[model samples]
Target: MTTNTQNLSGQSILAGAATTGNGRAVHGYNPATNEPLEPAYSLIDLDQLKIATAAAAEAFESFRSLEPAKHADFLDAIAENIEAVGAELAARAMAETGLPEARLTGERGRTTGQLRLFAKVIRQGDQHGVRVDPALPDRAPLPRVDIRQRKIAVGPVAVFGASNFPLAFSTAGGDTASALAAGCPVIFKAHNAHPGTSEIVGRAISKAVADFGLHPGVFSLVYGPGATIGQALVADPVIKAVGFTGSRSGGTALMATAAARPEPIPVYAEMSSINPVIFFAGALSEDPAAQAKAYLGSVSGSSGQLCTAPGLVFVPTGAGGDAFAQAISSQAPNTAGQTMLTEGIYNSWIQGVEALGGQPGVELLGRGTEGAGQNAPAPAIYSSSVEQLLENPVLQDEIFGAASLVIRYDSAAELVTALSKLEGQLTATLQLTDADHETAAAVLPTLETKVGRILVNGWPTGVEVGHAMVHGGPFPATSDPQTTSVGTLAIERFLRPVAYQNFPNALLPRPIAKDNPWNLTRRIDGTLTTTGE
Candidate 1:
């Protein structure tokens, strides 16, 4: 491929999407002190967005052809470089976002871990695929058609940085890492909320770019607040996929914009979820104290900031609702009111608490209490009958803060009906004792229908990067139902498989070579066999 020596202006990194009026840098400040966190690129225009995205789009053509092993090396390099700056990144996140030190450090580790996990998966270039068939050698004269599934890259990608996870979901976060591993070039639109941190991560990635002598356009970071910046990136003809994690309105607006494009691209935007936990009579009958302790920790961790935190708990009629509420309330009072991502976040969480108590059938079980600190308190609890919860959309939506609702169910039938009406969520929890395992088994199918993951008795936060992790859910939980936000499968969002039916052996991928270069699993002559089955 011919190369163009284009000017690489570091300035593009500072300017927000061009729509923010005349070109200028947007300097984000601390909401409390009203002091600048650091210098950041102001709103960028449509033209700049095009320039950045176009470069990444072109880079994909070359990057995709490299051997998977070499690809893995570059990916590992990116992770290492980011890990090197883990401390600095975390510090800046705390200073800028008003997040506590401990939380940011944990998030930094998660970010790097996610990068390495995808690196390990695609480094072998064995995009997980399997061929299944009943041995047809003796099945008859006519043979059965074999089925093979493989993952491949879709194309250039656009990732929007999120406010809550400045490090994990920012410029070098899960979305960017997975896309790059899948052989897709990435154009990241820095979140207006954290451009400085985004640049810091961007710089770390740039170091990897130089170290690997990578195709420069493989990574592009631009800044802008106005929807125009995001609009241009998602609508561009060259951008084929997008990854987003944010509020319902923000993600939905972007999704609509992506669809309105002349050629719609896949938008894997994880919107919001309430992540409900159901506790049956057997749960309380088994160990009410233990369940209470567990729920308190799950909902209160991260100040209930985690997307998968159990926001609603369903208790059987007279099944220790008071005990559970008291347990959770006791723990809530001790949690120091930490600052949320912004004043808007602090305010939103409080409103969710009020909206519940404001409802007719609802009663405040525990008013959200706060420990005086930098940010407002978020702990809020309310009680409602199963019918009240099932009928109200407001009660079902995620409060997005440290708030959980305790709903009392009269019977199994009522419990089933309430769950059936839930919105798709990243995870759903079941707190049951060993003796109630039979009951859990019976309801597993119902819970699995609307969530990406079902947890037996684990808190959904602290996502583990593995083959089984599915951080995305149905419909509004995520824009793409088939793609996941975690795990090796997350790479599928950036890939699309193409078949080579009866192609000349010489034209096959090297992984499928006479002597496999990467030594990957392959389907031969319609059989679950080796290179030459």
Candidate 2:
């Protein structure tokens, strides 16, 4: 099959327009066909980094002072612009990342949905988090001074895009959406795998900025080597915080860079996770076929590229467990080999499978149908005892592909011991029945300590973008578990609170002003209300 890669003018979008960056040239390739796409993108080196970040810093002055409703309009405009270019964005993303058209299309929707969600968040005024205290000048011993507090944008943000979920995690993705919603300008570093898609989305965001008559520096997208370009961005004094979604090593490196800066900055990175699924006795003993189908579907979706994929499953030992294992082995082989996002990911997955198969007390149960592509690999299932998993620490690392391990446990104590050994995860699932409530209750506390989102009798493949969704977890799952990268709260990562003491009403922030210009919800004299006493 012949396909035409877009003749994208590979250039960095610096402060709202395309520029041939002053750095070495980098080119993107079509992973499906192993063909290099047209036009070479100029890597943003140390010099271009200064220009982009400086623009963001300059823009933050005005951007942060804009009214909350104006910020909402800017965010809504970005969403509209993204929808305008949705078809082209999906097409470019599929050609570069080897993802199917439908998946890319849905991701485009998710990206725009996140933008609109944040727009609503800004308009609601909760993010401002205002509190005010009236002065008690008539006090006998000492007169109390008036005090006010509110949240404000940290400053310019540097966002590193992810290889998977190009539209939802790259360019104008969650990180950019949240930072912009917080009133911080963005200095985005596009992933090398999909520069064309980045360019297209970057252009759309730039157009939105102009349409709203905002500063051109409100958004910028650059591309280059991870070590150089990424490091430079994080180290820039103008960049107050960072947002990243990538491998553990990659995320850690950016974290180190931010820490080494003269004034250390926060790096909100979504790194690695081996989301585990535990099947209680009742769940394992009943409806084997349906459970098997759901398990396979979660593990094989997007070739298991999702961070929330069920990488490990625990089941009880004996006849019921054997039936579950048999069902898994039978259903797994039916899923055909899928084209991975990159050649490196495919090779790493093969090594992971080989390591698991060669480990002590591990058995290869099934292998799916293979496809004819350089970056395509078949899904595989392996089995081992809970004791073996406890013995081998290497088994806990993520493989980044379509694969999973089924561990059989002899007793409830053994299941707890095995789960205790797991590293921090994005999610954990409990396949339960009404009869298993006692067991579920016992494990709920442990699951809370090890994972961010706990699922009940459902797969963790789809993450909804909303007010309450937490797409982050402790440590390896993310740099900070307190913040989410996909919800309204994500804006908090780029915001910091400040208190105003003894300031006159005219000098106070609008949200905290005496007259309540914005009519925001705030605490006044220990009472929550829009009107001050």
Candidate 3:
């Protein structure tokens, strides 16, 4: 089959309907047939980076000052627009990523839902403004000044599109939606693998903006190749904060660039993880086979492209472990490798899995190659002692494809210790029973330290969008501990709190005093303040 590649190199791409990206268009191939899907080009590059970011910064000057209601409406419109183009977005995503239609549709639902959720959240925040701690006074001999807090928009935001969720986490996804809702303009750097999908989503966003009469500078989606474009974007004075989801080396590079900026900016880069799931003997003893059965779908779902997919499974070295191992082996090969997002991605997954298998003290427990051709090798599982994992950093890095490790421990105490060694992650699961619940309780305090969320017997691959949902975790899992990747809280990544002192009613934001902007919630004289206080 023949495919077309879009070329973005040496082209102008910002402030207009330009498909020309700064980098050359890489070919989009059909993994199944090993044929080209379509001609695709990357988004434009460095020169365009400035154009996009500058436009976004320009937009913030006005967008940041809009009434909170207006901001909420715009957010709502974005979700609505994404909803309108659901089919096109999902179809392109499947073609680019080689994922099944059902998965992409679910992701699209989640994506649009996230946008709407943020809209609701921001409107609610306005209805009952962000909370602020007020100073003590009246009852005291000495009076203190007022303390006020308002969510402020940081300047232009640079968002690096994700390779996996091209629509939900890319162009019009959580990063852009939340940032815009926060009243910050956005500069979205499209991920190379799915630039066509990015363009479609980007166009949807642009149309939404025009329909809403929003500032054009408020959103600029650019494409480019090479590290230089991203490096330059991070260094730009106009971009105050960043959001990213990709590999460790890639994330680290952007972060270092941000840190090196003359006016250093905040970068929220979510490095992928080998999300670990712990299964106590008691938990698995009753239904080790069942646990493995459920995990078959979770681990192999999307070929393990999800960061929250279980990568490391902890089990005792005995009959139970053997049963679980057999279960995994029985189920793995059945799910043949589907196509990954790109050839480059497929290759990387293959190499990384082999590299891990080849690591000292590590043994392949299952039969499969990492990734091959358009399809990935079947899910690969390796066994390593908890002690080895504790001593080796290699055991923790993410492979970004269909793979996992089974870590054996001598005792529950050692299991606890091994859990403690892991860095922040999106999730940690405990496969336990009523009896093991006691052990799980003890491990919670330690396990929670390493992950944003803790699950019991359920897979973390399908993130729910709700109030209690916390989709971000400690370092590497997410750059900021306070922000979540799913649900309403995700918008916080795009917002910064600003405080107002004893300013006249006109000068103060509604949350602080008599102005009562949205007439919701607030703090007054060290009390739970409500609107009209």
Candidate 4:
């Protein structure tokens, strides 16, 4: 439970075994100081990587059929092991990613809480998705044969760690938790920016696997070049599905590799999104200065490295809008930037901001003071017209930092037209009151198709992890809009339905068997029924 740099192997944990690779070694760097941390991690070759995938395939047979109690227990144990790491985990993550200790501590709790949530989901057994259609021996035209169905694990899954969230969206994050809950073996590709943090959490999961007496292949943590090993992992025939959280370019590249395989597989990749916020006249009439502060806080928080950060704001051109803009101009100059995840990310953010600022109609609204750190850059907000935003594609691209664009619109019709031109987004917000209901209703349909989640009178920076919450959207927001990367529904991404026709009770899966051994809720003849119902 007590982990430190001295005990860190900086090696790939393959099938519960510590492995050292001969390929190039990489070190985790402290972004706040721009210095490398101790214990360089060795990169694994493609052949070495195969060992993990092959073991995962071998483990799937037994793992996919685990008893509900044991399966739920395994997930619960993982949560406990991660929680036991405690302060050590937070300290290591802070050193690697330049995130504050308080933030990392809360993220670690969120990570464990989600694992435990999945444990509850496993015990309930509803995810089995069982259904039965009784045979009809006598019918006017013909007899109907017996048919039954239930969802099953797809197979081994490849998960890529995220850069922004070292704990909540990395190692044992939502993607890995949901895949494991669906009974799929996982081969996790650690993010190079936070190798040490990955190692600490990877060991926790490995310990849980050992404690449960499950196949060591149930989980494996790997390190390597993203271009070489990352794409190769998706291309591996043994891997049946993939879970990714990163850039649009990275997600599209993996989608291509997955499609090219002899047996194509699904890649549930969370990619780019510039979450937009719209301000109606009435909502801005009440204390525009306070509203502006709240808006800027969401934009600049976590250095705007969040996937759900509000990158675009729509304000009407009038007195209320003028008041809001004046408040932003007054407060934005004082906002400070925090250290970013990596040097490459910092450099890319700078380039994006410069390119956006150079656009034909874009003008700098305000700039904040730079924070005291190696990679910290000043936060910036730009302004543009609806006409320019609709005409120029560059104005819509996500800067991926503490930068946002404020677009001025002349009328409701113009606002809707400008919104229609936007790409798919993870979220959209409306600042409205009773007077704005008509305007809000007019735009609801378009927003339904454009975003996964809609917020009213609130910013989109915080995402709730629960059964009903969706962290995905159409097209560019994620590779598969039907699936979410967070919440219980995410388990479906790694599962597929299989039908059994005219099969004897003895040969049927437990969930759909005649005896009803698993005690699952099932749909029979289009009616929801449980045991004794």
Winner on TM-score (3 vs 4): 4
For residues 1-533, write the lDDT of model 1, one tens digit per residue. Answer: 10111211224442121123245666665644546654445566777676677677667778877776778888777777777766666666676787777888878778778887777777555564533232354557775543334556788898988877888878888899888888888888877776667767777776676667777788877776647778778888899989998888888888888899999988989889888888866667755767766766677666677778888888876746556666665655554455666766777877777787788798766543564454557566677887787677888878887777888877776777788888888888887778777767777777888899888766777788788888888977888777887778888788886654444557755555445556566665455445532
lDDT measured at residue 59 in model 4 versus the true structure, 0 to 100: 95
TM-scores, one per candidate: 0.89, 0.96, 0.91, 0.98
Sorted on lDDT, best first, the list reads 4, 2, 3, 1
Give the better candidate number (1 or 2) by lDDT.
Answer: 2
Q: Candidate 4, residues 403-430: lDDT per residue as tens digits?
A: 9999999888999999899999999999
Q: What's the true lDDT of residue 30 in model 1?
A: 66
> Which predicted model would earn the best lDDT?
4
lDDT of each: 0.72, 0.86, 0.74, 0.91
Candidate 3's TM-score reads 0.91
lDDT of 3: 0.74
Cα lDDT of model 3 by residue, 191-218, tens digit = 8777667766676677767776777888
Question: Which whole-number lDDT from 0 to 100 does residue 8 have in model 1?
Answer: 17
True-structure RMSD, every candidate: 4.6, 2.7, 3.7, 1.2
Candidate 4 residue pairs in clash (backbone atoms < 3 Å): none
Q: Estimate the TM-score for candidate 1.
A: 0.89
